[model samples]
Target: MERPIGVIDSGVGGLTVLHELKRQLPKEQFIYLGDTLRCPYGSKGEEEVIQYTWEMVNYLMKFDIKMLVIACNTATALVLEQLKQNLPIPVIGVIEPGARAAIKATQSNHVAIIGTENTIHSQAYEHALIRIKPNIDTTAVACPKFVPLIESGNFVLEEAKEIVEESLEFINHYPTIDTLILGCTHYPIIQSLIEEVVGPRVTVLSSAVETGFEVSTLLTFYNLYHANTEEIHEPAIFTTGKLHVFQRLKEDIFQLKNASLKHITLS
Candidate 1:
């Protein structure tokens, strides 16, 4: 009764979610797949995004995962409901949890969201927020350069800081916004930089963290909690692109000890 949780993302961005999952539910095993070959589903069309997300779901299903977490925002925005309807296992996405967190964090009734072009365009987070609280004001900005910078391993460089500052300039004029949602999973990789740019006043939210909480709640709701409190395997990692970068981040950035990663191809 210790089937693993399946977490999928377009790339290493989902590691942020995995980090939280591990912190919150240490006893549970996880199988994380990053479709890095097709990284940045943020730029793709709705159909292509949905197709790629399904390919991920199909790939992860082979592991007999007890739960599924769509850790990628673009995929969640485009394909989550469909996956929930069709997949036998319980499925959850990062958006609703993120929106709820934003609702809880914002005291000014104003929230700002930063994500990829497609995510902001979809207005998924805005709609989710509005559905619960009709009077909230939301402003969404697309930071098109972030995902690639993060995927390329340049997110920590000074150029990335410049880009973040430039891309977020719009929020400076948005005086009322007291909360900012990192709508794209990739954004949390540079959460400090975002907080620096946004200054100390506006609270930055990581959807990954909130998603982890939601996953824990559902694990209990569905009675899918891993019974082993002692643990089993070093969480398995798979990627459809080059392994070196993912490996470096997992070891150095995340300090995931003895974790094994493999190269994978998704049809």
Candidate 2:
């Protein structure tokens, strides 16, 4: 538990990032916290998202974590700069890496982004991409139903496919969008269906995967990489709400084994 990387998200969506992190940095130990009780920060106000994100960060800090990764896009959009300034440890968020990935993958200059209403409304991904490449054209759509569908454990079914198709009809209008950024961490869970609907020619950039790569690079740069060689280190998973749902999703959808869930109150 010494110097573990602390990763927090509004909910299980961050596990997408954490899964990649474990694969990329096999030697490092990690402690992940999901604010599942107050899930879906994407629709919340900026101030509320920031405050809740700070609470998660402060709670994780109590564990003496070496670094923090705010895996929620809403949190990143609302609070990344403030967290970087306020926290002594290095803090990272999902938006920049995802933006950079899209910038790299887009051959046509036209890119599409899908996320929660607030994330799309905030235009964080748009700003990040344009900041990196001013000429790039961006189209961001709010796929608010995607998160609820995934959380409800209904994303893999036929109805979910219909919803995915219906939701992506706008993509047909912009056939030039060769690259699509999955702005919400949760979107990656149903990425295959999305890809299928959008067709294979469009490259889907997963913020979760890109964020993991960023975390790995940052860990190397900071030299705070945990070299815990122990074959088994106790990695803790805590949820602010809905333990059974979290457990079922982790095991069934996320394929995360060997992690225990603890219920917590984030007052």
Candidate 3:
């Protein structure tokens, strides 16, 4: 029960989820692995995404994690079921939590989703939404350029604003959509820009909060909550690529000054 939870993503994007989890369950420890070197899994083939995701999971399993959180939308879409069935610990994904959040936020039962190419093409959010609310109206857009822009650490520039605007132009056509789901975990890093582009009429929701809540609920159900309240927990973060941006985000964005970060390679 004291074992750390494992969170994995294609890149630093998963930190958004990790941040929420830490806030919600302050006593629990977390180990994060971001496959930054071969990131942008949104455009990769299904087989490749599955393989890469499994590699990340296999690596995390070494730490004797109590649970696994698939923080990448593409990997969640492609491999969540397999991980859930095969792994001893519970597994949760961002898509269903995100879909539920969008459904709850929408006034018209119409929602829009924007994510990586593979996630959009997989229709995972749309299906999750419709399955929960059978009559929900959903529109999905594939923003293949987002991950690269974010990974470059240039998402704060004016060019990022233009890219976000251009990528979301289609949202204007859907007047009925009162809720927009940030389908990819990385999207929340640029949530303000996305909200500006789509305007105030639509509410932008990130699955991180809901995902964190779900994690807390599961931990309690299984009695996996960390028993020691006085322990200071510093998350362990790992990435397979450059560390500059990851380090900056950890300190500046996530405010995890004491979190341990290291570069890692997977074969």
Best by lDDT: 3
- TM match of model 2 to true structure: 0.94
Off by over 4 Å in 1: none
Candidate 2 per-residue lDDT, tens place, 1-267, comes to 247889899988888888787777766777888887777888888888888998888888898899898888888888889999988989999999999999889899999999998889889999999999999998899988888787777677899999999888999999799999999888888888999999987998898777888887887898776666666454578889777767776787666777778988998
Residue 11 in candidate 1, Cα distance off native in Å: 0.3
Q: How much is the lDDT of residue 163 in candidate 3?
A: 94
- Best-to-worst order by lDDT is 3, 1, 2
Q: Which residue pairs of candidate 3 clash?
A: none
Task: Quote each prediction's TM-score.
Answer: 0.98, 0.94, 0.99
Score each candidate by Cα lDDT. 0.91, 0.85, 0.93
Instruction: Report model 1's TM-score to 2 decimal places.
Output: 0.98
Q: Across residues 1-267, which tens digit of lDDT does each residue of candidate 3 receive?
A: 889999999999999999999999999999999999999899989999999999999999999999999999999999999999999999999999998888789899889999998998889998898899999888899998899999999999999999999999998788998999998999899999898888999999999999999999999899999999899699999999999989989899988889999999998
lDDT for 119 in candidate 3 is: 90
Q: Quote model 3's TM-score.
A: 0.99
